[model samples]
Target: MGTADAFHSSRTHHAAQGAAISELVDRKFAGRTFGGSIRRRLQVRSHDGPSTDAGRKARQAILLVPEHEGEASSIMCGWLDASRRVAELRPFSSVRTSHKTRFGSEIDLPEAEYEAATEALRVYLSLQAFEITFEVPVEPSGRLPRPRRLSSAAEVPASAPEARASESWGLIVLAALVGFSVCYLLVLLGVIG
Candidate 1:
């Protein structure tokens, strides 16, 4: 195919994917408020706490958003502690945090909640390329049972140790190839055997 045809095909594929993702997100988060900008995406929820640990204080706000910019694709959902010092995530992504710490503020999620949150994150990440700005009404009452330190379904970051090691190996092979080429050229010119 021609260059123009290939470009047009690629563009069309991306557009179709975007449309499908938007539809899926609309259906998935039918009744949740959508917040965040083009660069970031999040769903904001608020409701009464289920257990005493949550306390019968003011309505607690929960945010389902990406863990961090470095792991933009990795998402977690939870509210903050009373002190607001740490983000208490339930159904937390196992994608190691920026600090490389094994543990942090996380709570275990119930099976039902885990499924719901996992579906939500999947829907969110699907439409990540486009700007999502639709807001669904938050439930006035009833708790959405959810998780804490569960493994994340997000993709591993490119900078993971395994990925870095593979890159290093590639660089070494490339350097050896370049060195062999230089030696071969010198031999051809009778400068070295």
Candidate 2:
């Protein structure tokens, strides 16, 4: 195959393999992209053995591509799409937060929560042509919840009959090819005459 064709075929094969594995795990996979800029911050707090001490907070902002004007909507859409995927991957709880914007929207989330959500959004946005800034709080126990099973049907495996039929068809094709090759060899050797 040509280079492009080979690349396409390889991509398809990889996707199929991924789908097969995801199916076993009862998960669905989706991809997205963003185009603009992103900024993130993380905060952490340590409670001192029930003492009334306020938690620690850290703020960070990242500015990428200072010249991509008039692309905010595209960037927002990509971020939302990626956020949805993160929601799917960790289906246990909603990571919805309010953002505070001087003239736009307000997003408010805890440091760990925002980190998980923004990580997914960042991946999707990176697929597009935009800049990104990510600030994540370092929490040793912070992790996205495991993806839940969407339905009981998704948990079930294929039926035995279907699997048997597939195997039988494969064997039949192999036997037919082998038989045809043996006959062709005999004909070439004049043994069948």
Candidate 3:
């Protein structure tokens, strides 16, 4: 095969492998809760701004959390790819926490829960011929907080319902002010009371 043809074939194979891995991981842990203190977190997010903006990328991440209230322990894995022009993903829950800290408190997951997730992923990866294994420490050494970042004005869609609603209200207020001003000027000139 030509060099270019070989490269294309390899890329396609890798993409298919990645998709299979993602699907398997999500099915195993997407919504299951453990000991009422943990839940599987599989979040896929993307950003496709104006075509002129070449820095935009799509994101996919999976996190396993053992706690959500007070202190917490978690695991996270993610990757980025070129934009496919997809809709953005929003959080499944909108509930706010009482803590006002700048960062989350990280702690070790109970040995049982930690081992369960690690072993499951390791076995699946091997079965897929992906010679990879988790190298986690004896203790949970990473803090996997929910990712957050600010978006530029250009990144926010003007067609969003919230944005359109606020804009419509602003125009109505401006029209009201103009109408009131005209009435006041007419009264001053004795054109009308």
- Against the true structure, whose TM-score is highest? 3
**Residue 54 miss distance in model 1 (angstroms):** 33
TM-score of 1: 0.23
**Candidate 3 residue-wise lDDT at 58:** 28
**What are the TM-scores, per candidate, against the unseen true structure?**
0.23, 0.20, 0.34
Q: Model 1, residue 53: what's the lDDT?
A: 27
Highest lDDT: which candidate? Answer: 3
Clashes of each: 10, 9, 0
RMSD of each: 18.1, 18.4, 17.9
lDDT of each: 0.40, 0.33, 0.42
Regions more than 4 Å wrong, model 3: 1-13, 30-32, 41-62, 65-74, 77-104, 136-193
lDDT of 2 by residue, 1-193 (tens): 7974554454433233332332322221122222213432211111112211111111111111112345331111111111111111211122222122233463332345434544654554345422443223223344644554433422223254478789999999999999999999999999997
- Whole-model lDDT, model 1: 0.40
TM-score of model 3 relative to the true fold?
0.34
Q: Which stretches of candidate 1 lie over 4 Å from their true place?
A: 1-118, 126-178, 181-193
